[model samples]
Target chain A: MQGLTAHFGGITWAFVLDLFTDYGLFLVSALGLYVLMSAGQVSLGHAGMVGIASYSAAVLAVKFHVPFWLSLPLTGCIGMVAGMVYCYLLGWRLSGFYLAIGTFAFGEMMINIWLTSDYLGGAIGFSGIPLLARWPVLLIVLPPIFYALWRIEHSRIGLAFRAIRDNETVAGSMGINVARTKLMAWMIGGFITGLGGCLHAHRVTVITPTEFGIYTSVTMLLAILMGGLRTFWGTVLGAAVIYFGPWLTTTSEPRDRLMFYAALIVILMILRPQGLLASRAAR
Target chain B: MAEYLFEQFLIGISTGAIYAIVAIGYNLVFGVMNVLNLSHGAVMMVGSFGVLLLFYLGIDNFWLAVAFGIALALVTGLLVERIAVRPLKGNWWNIKVATLGAAMFLENFVTRLTDGRPMPYPRPFKPVYYTIVGDFEVSNVQLFLIACSLGLMVAMMLFLRHTTPGKAIRVVAQNPDLAQCVGVNVQQTMVLGFALSAALAGCAGILNAVTFGSTYPFVGQFLGLKGLVILIVAGIGNVRGCLIVALVLGVLESFSVVAGGSQYRDLVAYSALVLTLLVRPHGLFGEEGRTGREI
Candidate 1:
């Protein structure tokens, strides 16, 4: 068995484990974004929620000495509340590019707050986080999350999201409560993203404010765009590509890597705007 | 205390002038094309680099370097329109995302070329300070920035109001299909709009480099968004409102720095943006029911 695994470019078991954990995190966040996009809303601020939860959970673990199991759910609840409050207060009023900018501002605000606060470890990043999120934990956690998301996607609410995405006025005319449905999308997306953050914090054993900035938000967006936004499996495929595609094309020069990512986005936007795994019904 | 306040206010006005100039270009592109040029900031960075490259090549004339940079930016703008905007023209979301990709490409390309180091801008014009009042001083650069920005704004106003092609741009902005039906050369006008917007961005880049005495690959990242914020505050397509709102934002940012220190400056600015969007979604000068429409 070892020889058989070695034949695949001599990749180590540990590297494979790391890849799985990374995919788990990316998949959760990508799905978080997919939920919003399905409702015809784009948030350039999903990273803020991730950052908030990461910091909250990391603080609880490192400072309060709370156990991982309790801290994780508490972190998720914090994210849920923050997301709901933000959406109810601000997100409901904006749409399109206005919403994009609004969310972008929110993301920046989170980063700035993180950077300025010493309690969150500021620019140096919070460290000494226990690595509780192993491959087994991820394997165990992902299935239920996936099942729940799958259920949500096929539910009546999912139909409402699609209706809102297609046309808000028409959706309103069709008796869909656009505001409440969007609010639900935000809350659900936030909780999932927060869960991803918790997994990331424990898996990586360190968390930084910069880790959850506009760049990460944009990457999450790219994953959804590349995967095809309409389906769950597409998001999984996108998360896979987003995580491994760059690793597969690892270059010695960091500049080349950035260029490669940028080129991929540009080419993808030009050639396959609907993404690699667009739904058949979309066309 | 009063002297400090005066100084900060002066600084705010100068910074706001820079924002205004950049916001004007951003607003122009949005008005004519109805597509947010997310790459506008990256284009401005390219312009700054263009000037730096010229200076390295022994070009000491500031005006010459500025002209070269503006021309380079114009070309870049035209290319972006061709590649990112024109192809995805009626698809609003696609256009926004494509421009974002273009921005990422330009920023990374420059970062790669420059090796991510801050380049010192060539100080062609010497700083001359004058005492305005009791312990209040103003530099020649500040005055020049304000004067140049206002001059450009006036020139743009005249161009749009008087010239035939300028009028054609306005017509196209009003209704592209109508303009095309009336034989206004919609394609050329779109290109021209991009060129004009980019030229303004280039000018702002030169001014910013001079004012800050440095340029970097990511300089435009935040400033571009700030310009957009200024536009939003001023109303999407209103040139006069853009100028006023940019100044207000600049002053507000400066005051926030004085009140809460520099770290809170961005927090204050963005918070103000959220507040503005909430309180006056149509903007200070935007028409009602026209808040979210294509400019």
Candidate 2:
């Protein structure tokens, strides 16, 4: 209680900002990620790709002297292209647990390669990525992204992706282009995560490989899981819970925190197996 | 360079055998249950912890430790199924999520209890080596690990094939609905499957502690991940496929370490899994019908 009181100001501000920043971004990204995962293509390593996009934007803005406006979307585009290339290379072959493996490999490979390279600042990682992201920026950027994704989620294309998630063979029988739908989801998911990464990089003003490892991916998954995978807003709620839940709980132990997350995910799955918001089953 | 490479490669194979034992645990649960037991690796960790704690209590006997580890694992398996798994039955994703929770709980509990320190595990076999066929020198412990792992796999197979309970398990693995209909006591079978997997994991944990010299509190994540990767590489529920892939990964990882470096060893394992999955989703020797065999 004393610790909480002592850190009250920072905590309150962080809570509000986290609610806006992390929660908003996670909501935007989860839709895209859910789309891909539902298409029976799991990319466990996408957090790295998200990291790459974020860091790339940061580097371009801070080092290569690119304008923030120019770097942000460009970084996102790079992420999209990488996602496409990744999907093309392994998308068809990916399904079920195997796709999860491929994603994890991609993430691990990217981390290893980046960790060794001096250009991405390697082990020391990237710092001073420029804090161009602000409340106004969030207001301008987040809603549109969320609204766009929400639109997509309700579209026929979205339904097709959901179909694949439910049962690929059946989806194929119904003439849904499983591979193409997956490719699109991957691309879009990458773009959104990249955008989130870019914003995160700018906000933190520093980035490391650890910023985009399995933990980040798991966090995103947890947000989606906790919020309710079925609805877009649920992921937002989940992100808020994770983003600020720690600050609220204020436990100094990282292991305890992780345990909390792990326990939460399990409990959520058991209680609300369809996910927090529950994606309405494709009729 | 040759000597160094050979030593590292040997190390890789031994580590791979440890992973194989854990993979076998995942495969059994998956083969029977059709659900990914994300906690499978944690169970192995529990086994390690159980042995370590018992050993700390002045039980210097290696055999005694191993037996205790196995017994602890069996109990842990049963408890995990009852608490974490059974409640989430009928929901596959829930199983993964629940197991993950249980895993996190056990890992943190162990870490907190052990003060996050690395504890030494007494070697089951001496690290003394002998040159078998001139150029290839292998440690006695390595031989022991390989033999023990193979022996365990074979024993598991024999149990699955010959024993009444084993046949019942096979039936459950092959077809749970039919197995239940035929009065095979599906619930008990599931429990047995969990127990067997945990017991094997316990053995592997002991073997790993022996070879690696010490067990860390956070050992479960790495071990679990390797086992999960092996299971994916072998396909979801193919026991034979998992064993072969485990060995193949072990050998390949050894070669990659020989050619590249140790920092990227995990890189090789995950990449191999990705590549294998791309080429063959059913794994190296997996069949389409091999969904759930152990649970």
Clashes of each: 0, 14
Instruction: Please give, for residues A102-203, the per-residue lDDT of candidate 2 as tens digits.
Output: 777778777777776778887788887767777677788787777877898799887887788777779999999888888888888778777777777777
> Every model's DockQ, to 2 decimals?
0.53, 0.46
* DockQ of candidate 1 against the true complex: 0.53
lDDT of 2 by residue, B156-175 (tens): 87888899998987899888
Error of 1 at A32 (Å): 1.2
Shift of residue B229 alpha carbon in model 1, Å: 1.8
Tell the DockQ for candidate 2: 0.46
Prediction 2 TM-score vs. true:
0.90
